[model samples]
Structures are given as C-alpha cells and as structure tokens.
Target: MMRRLYQSLMAASRAHAQWEIETTTNIIKNRKMLIILLLMALPLIIPAMVHAASLPEAIGGKAAYGPSYFSAKMFYGSIAIGVVAGLVTGCIGAGGGFLITPALMSLGVKGILSVGTDMFHIFAKAIMGTTLHKKMGNVNVGLAVAFLVGSGLGVTGGGIINRALYNYNPVMSDFTISMIYAVLLGFLGFFALSDYFKVRKSELSKNKIGLEKLTPMAERMQSVNLAPMIQFDEKIVPGGRKISGVFVAISGAITGLLAAILGVGGGFVTFPMFVYGLGISTYTTVGTDILQIIFTAGYGAIAQYALYGYIFYTLAMGCLLGSLLGVQIGAITTKVVSQSKIKAFYAIAILAGFINRIFALPEKLSQMGYISLTPSTGAILTNIGVWVFFGLVAIFAVWIIGTFIVNVPNLRAEYDEGSKAEYNAEYGEDNKAVVSTKRGAAQ
Candidate 1:
C-alpha cells in the first residue's frame, strides 16, 4: 500500500514538474503579461527593496526580521530555498512542497506566515502556468466540479482554524504547525526509507518492475453502488468505473484542508485519492489533480492567507523564480540517473525534512512552557536539526549539479540527435531537399 502510494505521489510530482515548465515558458513568452504582473507587484517590490536591510529580530543572526519584514537576504534566501525544493521535486519526483513550510519555520518565519506565503506561491505559479484547454480531454467534468464544491468548504474551515489559532496565541500557532509537520514527516520519512531498502533488496535478487494490484480499500470503494455515481475512465477501462460523488467530495475536502494548512496545494494527496482511494485511472487522475491544485491553492492563498496578512509577496516571487530554473535542471538530471538511486535520494530528502521539523519542536514547546528545557538546549537541538536538514539538502543539490555538469556533453548529443530525428520524421524528403539546397547555396 505504501509502495503504491509512493508511485502515485511520484506520478503527481512529474505532472507538477511538467506544469511548472510549461507555465514558466508561457509567462516568459508573453511580455505584456509579465509586465502586467510586475506592475501589480510594484507596491510590494518597491517597499521590499527600500527596506532591504537585515533586522536583528526579524532576520535572526546579525539580522532581525518579522512577518512583514522583507530584506534583500530574506528574498534571496527564499529563492535559494525554492531552488532546493524544486530540485527535490524534480529529481525525486515528489515531496518538494513538503520542504517549504519546514524550511521557512527553520528560518524563524512564523508558522502561519510560512504556510500562507507558500500557499500564495503555489497559487501564483498555478494561475500563471496552467493551460487548461490542453488538459481538458483527460478531465472528468463531473468529478472536478464535485471535488471543488467540497474543496471550497474545506479550505474555508482550514483557514478559519489557522487564523483562530494564530489570533489566540502566535506561539500556539507555531507549535501546532510544528507538531503537525513532525508527525507527518516522520511517518512519510520512515515509510520511504523502508521502501528504499526493500527495493534495493529486490533489485539484488533480480526481481523488479512488478505489477501493482489495486488496494483492497479501492476495490471495496468501487464495489459499493452509492448514489450520484460519477462515471469515468471511458477512454482507458472497458466501460468505466462509478463511485459516489460523496466519496470524491470527502477526498477533496481532506486535500483542501491540508492545502490551506500546509500550503502544498493538494497535488500530493489528490493523485492518490483519485487513483487508489476512488479507483480512477491514472489518465483521468492527472488532469483532475491539476484542476484541483489550481482551485485549492488559489482559494486558500487568497481567501485564507493573503487576506489575513500572512503572505509575503517577496518570498513568493523569489521561490517562484528559483523553482522554475531548479525544476528544469532536476527534471533533466533524471535522464542521467538510475531509478533506484533516485528513490533512495527521495527517501533521504524526506527524512531530512522530517528530522528538521521534529528537532525544532523542542524549542517551540520550551518557549510555550510546555517543556521544561533550557532555551540554550532547545536552540542547540533546533540548530542541529537545521544543519542536518540543510546539509543533506545542500549535498543533494551539489551532487545533482555536479552530475549534470559532467553529463552535459552526453545530454546535448542526445538532444541534438533526437531533434534531428524528429525534424526528419516530420518533414521527410522535402525538408532534406531544402536543407541540401541551402547547403549547396552556402557552398
């Protein structure tokens, strides 16, 4: 079950990577659109630049910072963090968004602020990057509509909870978020590590690429003939599968709540819910997941976080720019690396994030007087977690970059040959003749 979940998560991550590439390309191509976006952000950008100095409280270290504080280093730091997260998503094929909140909290950003900012980042990326018309064929109109209905409600509830907690006590807000991340990361991280070892053992025995069976839960869910049955998978399956719209809505609600609280945009959960929970085909799941991501992220960011002053525009933009570049590099790197190795790295990255969050918990607990530990000890634990997490992340980045650099020649050759093959296949003799004629003229 965990292995299947891992596969589902990987598939979703690839879709997200592709989406980012396409969206980034579109944003770059449309000059007017870019200008309009820049103009809209002018107010925030100017203020951030004008006050681009380190604060003792806000920035920490020699620099201090707060929720509203925006310094040059903070902006640049967000970009750096974005790049690392993108690398993880691209290279490992999932779990990139998981790092953002933990990373932000590690950097001393309030939990609410971090979650809100990440949500906005996802939203901004989605709106700018999404090309719905192309994906419309794979989308189930009924499923999407129903899911959004529930997602809206879920987002609203999640936002209210977060805001209420934040308003009640900022420390409580931080502690709540930390504990949530700690539990989640710990579960996923440990499971992933175990999966990695299992795969390694299987590979040694020359047994790999085994077929996946549907989970018992999925079979049971599809077996029940619930009302308002939504039909789907006409293109893939014989006739189709039907599950109650209620099930779909419930899944969406869970996804939306997570998105609002965690700022992951719900892509991670949506794929698994559609594929494993509801027995939907992967073909249909991908498109629907994309739609869910845009809506859930957008609504949560704007209604929940941005409206409440939790978002940081500079950080969002920085992360956006950095992730765009990092994702492309990481995606291409996959071509050069082995699958088993990639899986191992993914497990490591997740575990690192898990450690980072868990370690930071002590400090928050101590601050709130829930734990009887000295501030220095709490700080020490937090610092250790930070170093371990960032150190592992930095190592992964360097390895990828180093590998990419070393293999660029081979990659370039492959690209050139592939392009030529495609060109010949498309144009055939006419293009060849035209090229020959051009060459003769030049000669």
Candidate 2:
C-alpha cells in the first residue's frame, strides 16, 4: 500500500512540473512575438502618427518626417488624454479645449493640426455632454439653436479677420503670431485655474435656484420691443422675453472675436452671454452653448483642412477616440455632484491653469530648446523636456480619468441641478412665456 501511494505522489509531481514548464515557455514566446510586432509597427506608424498631430517636419512629420499615420502610442495618448481632459472639463463645461490644445502644442503640433485635432475632440465631447444633458432634460433645444446662429456667423468673421491681420503686417507677422499664441496659452490657462478657484471658494448654496432670486431688473431691454418675441414653455415672472436683433448681432460679433482670438469653438463666452446678457439660466446656457460651438467648430475645422490644407488626420483620429468616451462619462457623472462643488472645482482648475500660464513655461522652455512651439506661421521643433512633458500629459490625463470616475456621484448631483434649472426656466412661473417665444423664435 505504501509503495503504491509513493508512486502516485511521484506521478502527480511530474505532471505539475510539466504544466509549469509549458506555462513559462508560452509566456516567453508570446512576449518575444509582441516585442517583434511592436518594433516592426513603429516605423510604419511613426510617419502617419506625426502627420496626424500635425507635427512640423520633425519627429517624423509629413514634409520632413514623411507622410504617414500616427503611432499606436500616439493614438493611445490622444484618446486617453482627450477623454480624460474632456470629462474633467465637461464637468464644468469650460475645460474641454483649454487643456487639449495646449498639450497638443507642447508636443510640437502646429497650425491647423493642433486646432483641428482639438476641435475634433471638442465636438466628440460636446456630443456626449449634450446627450447626457438631454437625457436629464436640461438641454434647451430652441435656445441652443438660436444662440448657435450668432456664434456661427462670428466664427466665419474671425477667419476673415485673421487673413486681414496677416496681410496688414507681413513683417511683424512672425512675432505677432508668436505673441498671440503665447497670449492664448496664458489667458486660457489662467482663466481655467482662476475660475476653478472662484467657484471653489464661494459659499456652497443649498438651494439649486441660482440666479432666480437675484435682483430683478425692471425689464429694461424687454420693454424696448426687441426684434422678435421669443417663446418658452415655463412660466416665470417674465414671460417670453424678446431677443434684440442688435443684441444678437453684438453677441455674434463678440463670439466670433473670441473664437478667432482664442481659437476655441466659442462656448466659453457664449454660455455666459446666454445666461446674463440674454437672461437664460445656467443649465440652458450650457446646453445652448454646446450646440452652437459644435456647428462653429465643425465649419472652422473643415475650412482649415479642406480649403487651407490644414489638420493632421492621424492625431485628430486619436483625439477623437478619447474624447468620445470621456465626454459621455463626464456628462453622466454630472448628475452625481452638487452644483456648488462643480463650480468650485472649475474655479480651482482655472486658477491653477492661470498661475501656470503666468510662468510662461512653454516660451522659456522653447528658448532653451526644452520644448517646441509650432504654428502655421512659426515653428519650433524638438527638445528633451518636451518629450518628458508629453509623458506628463499622459499621466495627468490618466489622473483626470480616475478622478472623474471617483466623482461620478457628485457629478450626477450637479447635473441634476443644471437640468432642474433648465426645466424650471422652460416651464416655471418666470420662464413659461419665455419658452413659448423661444420655440417660435428659434423656428
């Protein structure tokens, strides 16, 4: 009996050894195959990836780096960063492009490529955010369309102004372009960080009724018989307020100026105007702003790539993947957080970005060749820290994704408030008449 037991144990031990050996062998072989595939794929993908980001003739661009598609890593980065940044900003509604464009520029992306890629991501995000808002019944479809008309007109004008500026001072064009880029970077970053902090520090309101209880103006503009009567379903103190044609034109003009000057889709400025200047609620303003930005950016991006031959397709593709996923997640998350908290977070982020811009790290780094700054008019290519920053960008993006996931509950709460405000503005005492007019006017 003892001899048989010993024999059985020996047999079992042998079987276990064989299984381990096979597992080890397979792992090694698989790893080797993966390494070989990656090595082979790098050369094929590098050209395309660089082209996509619109990298200027270096690190393998189109003209110098040769025509090609972006790398697997680049696509991964854009999707990851784009999505995370979109979610992070989408929570507040202003951070979408703010984080994206700068990061792209830092990586030596130039001209229409950077802007176009950014827009692609912005559009993707907007779709997601808008959808989520719609689900929550926060999206004001009519008001959104009306506001879009104004912003659309403005974007076209901004492009014309850019051309005029270029023609006006060819000699100073290079320097002027550089200055503009710098200003844009600093301004956006500062605005983001400052806005984040401002909201964060403000007293948290238990009541979701923001702007409802504020000092009411005696309908000065409303009494002026503005161009056409707007409609709404919500009944508010003020019924169907009229939107002045002059106000609409002025709004469009400013919207266009910001789009041109800042190189954004123009939602940032448009949302505020819809809320204050036009007496729209925060919720409706955001929904409408998203709609308008979508159209404007869409047109601008197409004009850039098709007419002017701008845009790096590879990069845009990568960014698009990330943004689509991120925006959806962010919009969904908005429902979990409180309104005050969202505002607070936005203020803090804006303030941090603002401080960073004041340092002008990009320019200083460019001067030292630690980074590259690129544009259609001026280009700086390559450096070591720039490479490091790119990696940091990826890391920060991952961090944002993780952060949003954790904050989903809080985001959901805030979204609820925004949507609720949208509903109240559309159907409540003060806004019913407004809705009636808006629907008809928008049509």
Candidate 3:
C-alpha cells in the first residue's frame, strides 16, 4: 500500500515534469513566442534599468535588484540556479522549481523578493509556453477557465496574507516562508526518497512496475457527480469523464494558495491534484496545468507581490535567459541517459532542497525569537545548509552536462536517423522534391 502511494506520487511528478519540458521546448523553439516574451519584458526592464535609484524601496528596505544595476555576480548566480533548475526539470520532468526559492534565500535574497521574483519568472515562462500546449490539443478550455477562477481568488487571498505578515514583521514573514518550505519539501522529499528506494529494491528483485495503478481515491473522485460538471479530453478517454467544476476549483484554489505562498508556478501541485485527487487524465491535466500557471503566477506576481515592490527584475530575467539554454541541453541529454538514473537524481535534488529549507528554518525562527540561538550558530547552520544544497545541485548539473558531452555523437546520430525516417515517412525515401524543399528552406 505504501509502495502504491509512492508510485502514484512518482507518476504525478513525471506528469508535472513532462508539462514543464513541453513548456520549455515551446519557449526555446518557437520564434514568435521568443519575440513576444522579449517585447513584453522590455518595458519592465527598461524602467528598472534606467531608473533603479528612483524606484520605491523594496520591502524591508532592501534595494531591489533591478536590471539597470546589473551585477555580473548576481547574473551568474541566477544563471547557475537556472541551469541547475533547468537540468532537473528537463531531466526529471519535475522538482526543479522547488530549488529556486530556497536557493535564493540561502544567497541572502529577501524571502518576499525570492517569492515574487520566482513567480514573475514562472509567469513569464508560462506566457510564452502555454500557446504550444493549446495547439497540441492537450488543454480543456472549460476546465482551465474554471480552475483559473478559483486560483485567481486563492492567489489574491494568499498574496494579501503574505503582505500583511510582511508588513507586521519581516522576521515573521521569513520564518513563515521557511516553515512552509520545510513542511512541503520535507514531506515531498521523504516520499520521493522512499519511492527511489522502492524502485531500487524492485530492480534488484527483478519485479519492476513501469506505471502506477490509478488510486481508489481517483476512482472515487471520478464517480462523484455534482453541479456544473466539466467534460474533458473526449478523444483521449473514451466518452471522456465529467467531474464537478467545484471540485476542480477547490483543487485550483489549493494549488494557487501554495504557489502564492511558495513562489512556484504551481504545476507541482496542479499536476497531482488533477491526475490523482480530481482523477483527470494525464493529458488533460498537463494541458490544464500549463494553462493555469499563467493566470496563477501572473496574478500572484503582479497583483499580490509586484505591487508591493517585492520583485527583483534582474534575477528573474537572468533565470529566464539561463533556463532557455539549460532546458534545451538537459532535454537533449535525456535521450542519452537512462530513466533510472534520472529518477535517482530527482530524489536527490528534492531532498537537497528539503534539507536546505529545513536547516534554514532554525535561523529564521531564532531571529523571530521563537527559538534561542547565538548569531554565530545560526549563521553557521545556515551556511552549512546552503553549501550542502548547492553542492548537490552542482554535482547533479555536472553529471548531466558531462554525460551529454560524452554522448553527443550518439545523440546526434540518433537524431539524424530519426529525422531521416520522419522525412522518408512524410515525403518518401527518394523524393527529390523533399531534398529541394529542404535545400530551399536552408538557403
């Protein structure tokens, strides 16, 4: 039973990862999307760069790291975080975003700024990437709209709560954020580690299961008939399934609340809620997850946090730039590496994030006078957490990049073979027209 639960969680994680990968792919390959994102970002960037000093004081009086005062160190730091995150996202298909907030906090970024900046980065990415998912026929428009309505409400509430707490006391706000991360990441990390061990044990026993069976909870949710039923993914699931829109909204609300509090895109929450809690098809879940991120993150970033002067434009943009390249490289690397290897790394990455947040909690609490600790001890513990967290991430990044470099020839050959097969299937193996068209396009 425990194993089954772990399997379900792992499956949900995979669903989230795939959604992220598809979104990242769209951001990288779609020229129009790239242009649109750049255009949207320019107005915000220009002012931040040109009038950095005149900007409103950030929460807690920390100067906002606007683009104008671009620090090479901060830029590189953001890129490093992005590259690791992208590698984790592309390779494992989830858990990459989990690291960003904790990483930023460890780097001495204010808690509110980390949350706000991360949300903005996610909103930016979602805007560019969501169109592709819609085109691919994965999205259920009715379901997405309903979910966003609830998510919007949740974001507003969560944002208000965060700001209210920050206004009351910065230490309390930091403590609150750290505690949230500790609990969520701790739970997720524990389960992920368990799942990893289970997989290892199964491999040794020669009794591996590739996919998790749908849970009884999922089955029960699907059977529930309530008002305003949402019909989704008729083509994927025969005759499709209908569930209460209220249930979906509830799920979205939870996702949004967590996202606003944690500074994530909420795909991590949405994927599981739709697939397991609400019993939506993975196909529909992926589509809806992508669709809702834009709304949830956008509202949370702009209305909830940005208006309060919590966003760091430079960090967000730096992450965006680095992630684009990192995701591409990481996605390509997956073709060369094995899934078992990927799963192991995913577990490690999540646990590293959990450890980072959990260890930092004591320091935050100490500052809030919730606990007694010397300044030196708190600083030392925080430093240790930061180092261990980043070390694991750095090692994982190196492993992925090294593997990709070593297997480049094999990946290239495979790509060439696949392209040729696709070309032949579409235009025939000996079609001169295909060659001419390709040559013309290249020219």
Model 3 C-alpha lDDT per residue in residues 1-443, reported as the tens digit of each score: 55544544555556555666777787778898778768855765555444333334553223343312233455567878988888888877767787888887776677877899899988877776755545448888879888998899888878888888877876677779988888777777787676667666453123434222355777787788888888986886679878889988888888898889889877767756776677677667766776677788899999998888888877888687767767778889988887777777887888888888878878778877878999889888888888989999899999999999999899999999999889889878568777988999999
TM-score of each prediction: 0.87, 0.57, 0.83
Give the alpha carbon lDDT tens digit for every residue of 211-282 in model 2. 432214324544556654455325344554455555655665677556654456675565445544555555
Model 2: residues with Cα > 4 Å off, grouped in runs: 1-77, 90-94, 124-148, 163-210, 213-220, 229-234, 260-263, 283-287, 327-395, 398-443
- Candidate models: Cα lDDT each: 0.79, 0.49, 0.76
Which number leads on TM-score?
A: 1
- Residue 294 of model 2, lDDT score: 61
The TM-score ranking, best first, is 1, 3, 2
Q: Provide the lowest-lDDT 10-residue window in model 1.
A: 203-212
Which ranges of candidate 3 are over 4 A from the true structure? 1-9, 30-72, 133-136, 201-225, 232-240, 429-443
Q: RMSD in angstroms, candidate 3?
A: 5.6
